[model samples]
Target: MAQYTFRTRSSDCPYELAIGLVSGRWKPRLLEVLKDETLRYGDLKERLKPVSDKVLSAALDDMTRNGLISRTAFAEIPPRVEYALTPQGESLLEALGPLRDWARTENGR
Candidate 1:
């Protein structure tokens, strides 16, 4: 069975409530892509080619619902919707910086 971590301040889980907000493969990747600029749905699909549309949609929806990403709608001939990270998401990205550095340096990535 797929298990989720539910931890308190003293709980055994290494991360806190914040990390749990982005506890999936595509979540981190999605955030990484959105760190510098906004991306549209098709852009996301193109950038994350290995991920299926269904999985990408689910991850983006989850992030949006969790106050991580913002979805903007524009009235154009074909319509435009862009996604960007919210302040909370930006904070999360900052927090993960050190960990990302460690992962690259120590894990030889």
Candidate 2:
């Protein structure tokens, strides 16, 4: 994956920054899945079937690094880890509503 740097410049477009944040193949889908509820790693792996373990782990790490998601780990016999969207992530999802509507309308749904 290519590294992206978001610079705070007057000429920098906010749209680009937003797009960069959710630019991965699995990111938007992951956000949608996380929108409804907090899920464990295994649960997410199961829900997003056919997604390889390495790719899923990397995507989760990237999302977490970008502040789009939160990871919580619990100490137990088997260990527990959960993922959920952050406030910024939720806001991003809400912002996607219009885009979603536009796509649906374009598709004549």
* Total clashing pairs in model 1: 0
lDDT of 1 by residue, 5-102 (tens): 43221234447465677778899898899999999999999998899999999999888987789999999989999999998889888888998999
lDDT of 2 by residue, 52-95 (tens): 99999998998898788999999987999999999988998999
Global lDDT of each model? 0.84, 0.84
Candidate 1: residue pairs that collide: none
RMSD of each: 5.3, 4.6
CA deviation > 4 Å runs, candidate 1 = 1-16
Which regions of candidate 2 deviate over 4 angstroms?
A: 1-11
Clashes per prediction?
A: 0, 0
Worst 10 residues of 1 by lDDT: 2-11
